[model samples]
Target: MDFFNFLAFYLYVYKFFLPKIGRVLLFREKRIGISQQGESTLEEEKSQIRHGVETLVTEALHISKGVLGDNLTQTSQWCEKKKEEIQKRNWKAINGSYISSIGERALSGRLAFLPLFPALPPQILWSTVSSKLKTLNNTSS
Candidate 1:
């Protein structure tokens, strides 16, 4: 259980919720020369990767399960921060404000339309935060 292990499971959950995205867990190894022993090693590597992902989902809930749970519980902090910035019009002078605004509008629309879908509310909420953060990133770029 580690950061990369947690990331692997995060991606797996996303794939489960959005199956159309067609994400797969991949294990990459490069060997200059192939042998029967090497093939067996490859199979073992794949098995380990699969087990790691399964552990993350079924038992661990990410290597940082407690940390992730705490993080999720702080969702209100995020909304409060965003709501404050919106009230302040903090990005009015930023050039990427348009993209930020577009994302905000998109998120608002998504929230308005998708609350009944159970799987989409949290995704839309996080996307909104990420989209707004993208504006700050673009502004600095």
Candidate 2:
């Protein structure tokens, strides 16, 4: 698959797996469940998710910049639209993969671009994408 597909797969893995990992790991301990180590592991996983998300965002921004320039058109619209979809749909989805985004900030960040794609459900996905576009606007300003 391409880079965007890679990113989507990466994010999906972390987004779905991290929390489940944390739950299982933490609960595997004592009757009370969740040792200090388990908690720390969860935190570490969260940190990794955050880092991965940042990397994903960086790569996407780089791609958009390369393809869309400072201006957007139909030719380059998919990148920005995809960005919005990611941000909007999975602001919450990213929460579990060892890290998370506050939904409002993420949504605001992604919505910075216009002529965004129209899609169904999966709010966090859309939010992610919209946030990416927003952040790029912030950087340019």
Candidate 3:
């Protein structure tokens, strides 16, 4: 399979296996008398997911190198560049910009009832919110 397909398959498998891994980790933690709350904290879950992704990427890179030989160098470099790009991303700034835009629209009275009413033409804010709410409802149910 191509790199995108390979990456996606690994992600799918990782997601499939993650719960089993979490169970094993929880079992070990209980045996050691740690994690007395009987649940993994959010940070611990994030750490496990991050580590799992890193491991999958590293394994994929090795397999690609074996299959592609000399051509894999470019792919490895591209992966590293993309990793750097992801690491350099400023999520807070991005969120701030989105919130500021919404605030500006609201203050200008263009989106007076943002949560209840849709914005004027050329903006699909209500549709976005509707879809998001549907997704949340589906997930919760």
* Top candidate by TM-score: 2
lDDT of 2 by residue, 1-141 (tens): 599999999899899988898888777765345567678889999999999999999999999897776465764687888888887677634543323334446556555543364554458666867677577555433
lDDT for model 1 comes to 0.69
User: If the candidates were sorted by their lDDT against the true structure, best first, what order would they fall in?
Assistant: 3, 1, 2
Worst window of 10 by summed lDDT in candidate 1: 23-32
Q: TM-score of the candidate numbered 1?
A: 0.23
lDDT of 3 by residue, 1-141 (tens): 599999999898799888889899999978766554435665688899999999999999999878897667878999999887774575545655665565555455644565565345534765765565566445433
- Give the lDDT of residue 49 in candidate 1: 99
Query: How close to the true structure is residue 61 of candidate 1, measured as C-alpha lDDT?
Result: 56
Clashes of each: 0, 34, 0
Summed over model 2, clashes come to 34
Local distance difference test scores for all models: 0.69, 0.69, 0.70
lDDT of 1 by residue, 4-109 (tens): 9999998987777556443322112223335667888999999999999887687755557877878887987898988878856765556366766766686687
Regions more than 4 Å wrong, model 1: 1-94, 120-136
Candidate 3: worst-modelled 10 consecutive residues by lDDT: 132-141
* TM-scores of all candidate predictions against the true structure: 0.23, 0.27, 0.22
